[model samples]
Every structure is written in C-alpha cells, then in structure tokens.
Target: MSDRAEAAVRVIEGSLRKRGRLRDSHITLAHGSGGKAMRDLIEDVFVGSFDNPALAALEDQAVVALSELASHGDRLAFTTDTFVVNPLFFPGGDIGTLAVAGTVNDLAVSGAKPLFLSCGIVMEEGLPVEALRRVVASMKRTAEQAGVYIVTGDTKVVERGAADKLFINTAGIGVVPEGISISARNARPGDAVIVSGYLGDHGTAILVARNELALETQIASDCQPLNGLVETMLRACPDLHCLRDATRGGVATVLNEFAQSSGVTIRVREAALPLRQEVKGACEILGLDPLYLANEGKLVAVVPAEAAQRVLAAMRAHPAGEHAAVIGEVTGEQAGVVVLQTVFGGERIIDMLVGEQLPRIC
Candidate 1:
C-alpha cells in the first residue's frame, strides 16, 4: 500500500477503536424522525465511524478549498451510483463495500484520483442495527484503503416492506491530472486492449449467494477500489487512450462502447480472456456469458501498442490487478463492432445485450 493509503487506514482503525460501540440493536422509525434518535444514530454510526474534518463539521455540504483541489490535478471527475443488490451481504462483500468501491472505481476508470465521497443510505425500519453497523464498517475500511474520505452523507428510514433491507447511494469526486485525456473516443487502431483481472466473479458470486442456482462453487465477488492500480498504470503509460471499469454491463459492454465511440473494430481473443475456474463453471451451468457478466473491480484499458508491455507489467504488480491480461486490439475494419475470435480460430460479433440479462447484480 502507498503511504497515503496506509495513513488513512490507520486513522480509520484508530477512530473505530476510540468510539466504543453503537447502542442500537435494530433500526426503528424513530431513528429517521429527525429527533434525538436520529441524532444518536448519525453520531454513533456514520459520523463516529467516518471521522474526517469535513464530515466532523456536520454541515449540509462539505466545503473544500480550491487550492487543495487544484493541487491534485487540472480537472475534476464526478460520478454517482446506487447499490440495491438482492442479497445485501454477499460472499466476499456487502452493500457498503460495494457502494464505496463502485463509486471510487467509476472515478478511477475516468483517470482520476478519487478524493471524497457522499453516502446516502435508506434503511428499512425493522432492519437490524448490527447489519447496518457491519455495512458502515466495511465502507470505512474500503474508503481508507482507497485513500478517500466520506465527507458528507444522509440517512432515511422507511417502514418495513418498503425497502428490501438496505439501499446505499454514493457520489464521489476525483481529480484528473493534466495532459491525461482518456475516453472511449480516444481509442485508435493499433492500440492494445487490456483487462485488469478476471471477469464475471462478481456477477456469478451474486447469483450463487442468492441460491438461484443450486451449483455450489466458491466464487467470491471481485469488489475493490481500483484507483491505486490505475495510478500505477498511468505512471508506466501516461499516454493511455481509454480506461473504463467493467461494471454493470461487464467487459463486453465496455468494449462495445469503445468501438462505437472511437468508430473502430475491437478484436478480442477468447484464449486471452481471463477467467476464474469457479466463475467459468458457474457461467456454464447457468447459461451465462462471462463477457456480459458484471465486474466491480476489473477494468478495460486501451493504450498504444508500443506501451502495452509496460502497462501490463504495472498492472500485474498491483494487488488488485494481479490477473491482468492483454486480451485484444483495435482495428480499422468493421467500425463500431466488437469481434471475438474463438479459441478454435473462428470469429463472431459480440454485440451489446438488447435487454437486461442480470439485473441488480451490481
């Protein structure tokens, strides 16, 4: 871990130890009444856990100095995402970790350094407070690991049955360094396409967690913050063309987007695609395509062919990108299309899904 990330983790651990414990065992309607109950909930759960100067002020909005923001980069990148996974607690992560990592990855894939986040949680009145606490703790740990702060947030409670247990929304801000212009439109012929790690683990893990399929495989969700990995890649290949997190629509969706935006054909080799054994088995049993499965931590980067080796080396050195691979390349033929070359030497068009295959997996 980097020095900044290590320091953030230390701060989070120290704060958790200092704040004894949350007293409420279960959430009630009173906690959302904007009274003493609400105050206690916020102070004990959210504020106490995510201790930071901006959040400590207890203001409606976080105040940040322009000088502080400008020091990191030339432009700001902002993104928001909502988490409503069917099973709040999955095999490897819960809603809270997903919320933090999801939003942070969004900014990171935009070639930005994530700095701050805003969390908005909706709790079911009868939900157990312990569950909420567990989720909050995960968020704290993830934010620390990502070297970002949750500077502001809000909470709301709804009657039982109104909400599935808990729903979390996160908005994040990041700084994009000067001369770093990464976007789908930047993809060009002769550029190398790379995937940070194994795909479909997250989407498959969610399905197994829900017991929708009787197959029992140990596929855990690949939910993680990618800013650190992205930073490493940028340092090695500053002229990267495009970087995108394979989230809701997975790598196939991202490739299609790049193809459309850049008006180039992306040809991927099936033999080069990375996949975990368990995830592959699960997908086969469920009649799912790993290419279309959602991935919370993985990313697809487009970089000049000359820099591909260095960029791939940088990614493999990072913990989050140990399984990175050079899966494809950009081509001028058949613009706005993604072609997957099978292991058997045959090729087929990989188009975007016309309808939702797996909803709420992220």
Candidate 2:
C-alpha cells in the first residue's frame, strides 16, 4: 500500500481505540477469561467485523429460522473443517479464508447452497491484535463472496508455547435443492470426469510460501470460494453425479473416493490434467506428483456423457473455472480403481497417499 493508504488506516484504527474500544495491542490469556477483556475482544474484533443481525444478537447459539432454510431446499448439508496452515497469511489467502472457504466448498460440492457458518478460534498468547482483526476481516469478506453468513463463533486463548500463532475451525450449514442428489457413490460408468481449473496451486503456494525449498516463484494459492462456480455448473448440469473440491489428497484422492464408493473405475489422462508451469516445476524439483497435490479453488465433477460438454462450457464461462477441462471418464472394467493415462503413453495407477505428502495444509 502507499504511504497515504497506510496513514489512513492508522488514523481510522486510532480513532477506534481512542473511543475506549479494543484497547489492547496484543492478546493475552485474559482475553479468554470471560471477563471484560474477553468481551472487548469478542465485541470489537469478531462480532464487530462479522456484522450481521444473527451474530449481533450475541446469544450462546445462533437461531436461524426454519422457513428460511426450507425456502432454498429440502435437506440440510452440514460440514465442519479446521484450518491450521503454518503461516497466518499467504499469497492469495490466509487461515481465515481457508476456514470459511473449506467449509463452504464442502457444502457446495454436495449440491447445497451454503447459508451460515460458525467460527471457533484458538489464539496463542502474545499474538498481535491486528492479526486477529485482519483474519476476522478476511473471514467476513470470504463469507460474503460465498453468499453466506458468519452467524456465531467462539474464541479462546492459549499459552504462547501451547499453540501455534492461530488456529481456526469453521462449521457450515447449507440447503440442498430438491431433486439434486450428488454423492461420491453417484458416479457411474461412462460418466465424464471434469476439473474446474489449474491443479496443485494451493499446495504449491504453501510450499513456496515457506521458502523451505529456497525456490523463488510467483505462485499464489488458488483459494477462492468455489460456491459460485458450483452453482454455475449446476445450472448447466442439474444431474451432476459426483462432486468434490479436492483438498488434502488433491484430485487423485477425491477420484479414488468416488471410484471406491460407486464401485467403478475412474480413468484420467495425465496430459489432460491442468497445471501451472510453476507447479509442474516445483513438483519435479520435489520429486512429487502434481496429481496428488492439493487445490483450494478447484473442483472435480462427474457428469453424464451427454451433458459433459455443456457443463464444461458453463464452467469455463465462469471466472472460477476458466481452465476447466474434462480429464477422463468412468469405466466398469476395474472397480474401485483410478487409472491415469500418462503423457508418455503409459497407464499408471493413482492411489491414495500412504502418509502425509505435506502437513499443516488447510
């Protein structure tokens, strides 16, 4: 930011503090003691940032009207996830973004429209109050982008040595539309396999962000909310069979889940896999396979062959899926298996990782 912008923000923050609010520059254990300190942190930082009618109530639990949920769909889709990324911030996102996006995408991929999220935070003592405020702002922005609300949350503080700088857990609730039935077990033979965009960017970004490889590159985490993109795909192909946003185990792992659950075989062309140049280079340097690398913004979809092109086109038209491609198809020949047709004209089996390929990833 420019000097002018920095000054402007400081002035605004100074004014806020001068008003006898959020007086602390850093967090202490007292913030978790349920005293005035805790109230100030919750009111000034969390609820203040996530300004919504439901959260403003400041009740022990959020109370959402049943009719509001019934208006959107017939069934509820609820999911929870924790974000423990090593660094609080990254190239394109932060722990806050992951907390919201991860839970929201989980609901979205299940063919549900995400509605509300609950946040739970654990802060390490001595952390900067500014960091917490920044993360809260990120969560609010991301929730808005996904068309959801942060309606309730809790905060706790731990001793400096007992925890990382920060950790976040988010649980989301979404409503599934009537007549939509998406599941890993829904994939079948002849179904087309599609991926939303470039793969492995999130994992690569974290790896690069750590500077552990001592490699310099301009790779940013593809960590935007995928709910919008999922909705666009649904509009084009309402009968989407299987859907999932590949995270820890990446696309390969998600495909494996579909294959095993549906009792079918999934074949993906290695050449058809979308990859950024930097990711490919990094994977090669680390002797890793890009197929197993994680992605935050991308999704894997299985749709009937007749509607594959239409869905792919619709996805490509959306900003979130401009690089979308049909990687392969489902087959009945080998049940519970994922095959990768290599660029080298060979077939390789894509299996789940036996252990952690990378840890502390969202």
Candidate 3:
C-alpha cells in the first residue's frame, strides 16, 4: 500500500483500540444535565474514541491555523447535515456512520478535501447507553477512514418521548484546490453524465430494515465516505464540470438540478442505469421508481466528453465505484429538462417530485 493509505489504516486501527466501554445499560436525565455525569459521559465515550490534539483540548471550539488550511487549497468548502434515520441501526451501517459519511460526501463532491467536523448528538433519556457508545465508536472509525477529525461536539438529552432514540447533526469544513471550479452551473452542452455506482441501495435497505412492507431480502445501505473516490476522479479529470451526491432525491433529482442550473437538457438511458438485483426487486414490488430513490454513497459527475472515458476508468478503479458507468449526456435542446428513455424505446420527462417519496431515509 502507498504511504498515505498505510497511514489511514493505522489511524482507524488506533481509533478502534481507544474506544471506551459504556457501563451504563441505559441513559438517564443526568447524562445531559451539564453536571459531573454529563462530563463523564462525554469524556469516556466521545473524547476517548475521537482522540486527537484538537479534540483533546476539550475547548468550546477548535482552532485551526491559517497556514495549515492554506496548504491544501485556495477556497474553503463548508456544509452541515442532520441525520435522523429511523431504526438507529441498519444492515450495513448505523446513524453514526451515516452522519459522518453524509457530511463528508457533501464536502467531497464540491471538489474539496474534507478536514474537520463538529458533531452534535441528541439522545432520548431512556435510550441505551451502550447503544450511544456503539454509535460514537462507529463515528470515530468513519472519521479516521475519511481522514477527518471530530474536533468539537455537544450532547443533549431529552425526555424519552420528546425525541427519537438518537439524532446527530454534523458540520464539516474542507479545502477546494486551486483551479478546481466544479458546480452544477458549469455543465454545458455535450458534457457526459456519469454515475459512480448502483442507485437506491440505501433507500431499499432502510425500507427492508423497517419491515414495513413484509419483505425479506439482504440489502445493505450504501453508506460510505466518498472523498477518496472523488479525489481519484479529480486527479483524472481536474476540469470536471459538475459533481453532486445522489442523496435525498437520488440520481433523478440531481440530474434535474443540473439541467435547470445549467440551462441544458440531460438525456439518460434507462438501460444504462445500474441497479442491484435486490433494489430492482424491491422497487418493483413497492411500485416505486429506482431513479427517484435515495443513495448515501453515490454521486453524479458531468465532465467534458473528451475526459469522460478517463474519469470513468479512474472511478471504476476505486472500490467505492466499481460499478461506475456513463449513463447519459447533456444537450442544448429542450433546455432545463431531464428526459429518460424507457426500456420500451419511449422517452418521458422526469420532473422533481412535489412531495418526498421516502421520508427520513437519509
């Protein structure tokens, strides 16, 4: 492995060893009472796992030097997201992993290298303390894997029925390298549209985990950090026109946003889209469109046609994007619209949904 890769592995391994055991089976109101109990919980759980000089200080805020930030890029990218997925635990990941990956992906797709994060966690009074420890450990592992740090955080406890078992809000900061100006409006006519991998895995996995449809299938949420994958793609195609994570509204919503922002039409081929067998089956049974489902780890890239092949090749080389494909292209005709050619050879416009199809799946 490369030196950088080896270092990352070590970080994750060290974090795993530092995780603290939570002795309390269940949480109580005192854990959030801003007293000794709260102090012990924070020190033993979050700080123990996410050990680093910045976080070790236990200050009200983290201070990063300007030179340290300037060395990475000329522009800073900042974003925040809240994760409240029902059923705190899922097949492949839990709320903690989702919280970290979601925020990291947001920064990554903006052509940035994610660096720091602040986490705010809310726990219900009666929730299991062990469960909180597990989630915090997961977050620590994910941050190490992503090469970012959780520098500051806050914890709150609410009445048992006033909140869900747990909820997490994360704010992230990253550095956008010089000469990299990726944006939805940068997409132009003839730009090739690429999807990193299969769609709807996350939405389908959450649906099955909830057991709301009485369906049984082995599908795991595609919740993962995409910064490493995005970094590889940028190396191959530095002039990438646009990049957007296929989150809440999935690939379809991302494409529509690109079309509207760039004032160009996006034409996607139905057969070219990639979907896992389980996801396809679930969508069929649920009478839902896979294109509109949510995905946590996937992203859509629009680059010049000349660089599409190189970028796609680079993406496929990464583990996170093994199923990457060139699914469509941008056009000047029918501006501000997205057209999907059906498997039956019919074409139809894809519009943004007036209401959400799946709520709190992310």
Q: Estimate each model's TM-score.
A: 0.93, 0.94, 0.93
Give the per-residue lDDT of model 3 (tens digit) for 14-53: 5554464545778888889998668768778888889888
Between candidates 1 and 2, the one scoring higher on TM-score is 2
RMSD of 1: 8.1
Q: What is the lDDT of residue 140 in candidate 2?
A: 89
Instruction: Give the residue spans of candidate 2 off by over 4 A.
Output: 1-20
Write down the RMSD of all candidates, one decimal each.
8.1, 6.9, 8.6
Clash count for candidate 3 is 0
The local distance difference test score of model 1 is 0.92
Model 3 spans > 4 angstroms off: 1-23
* CA shift of 337, model 1, Å: 0.3
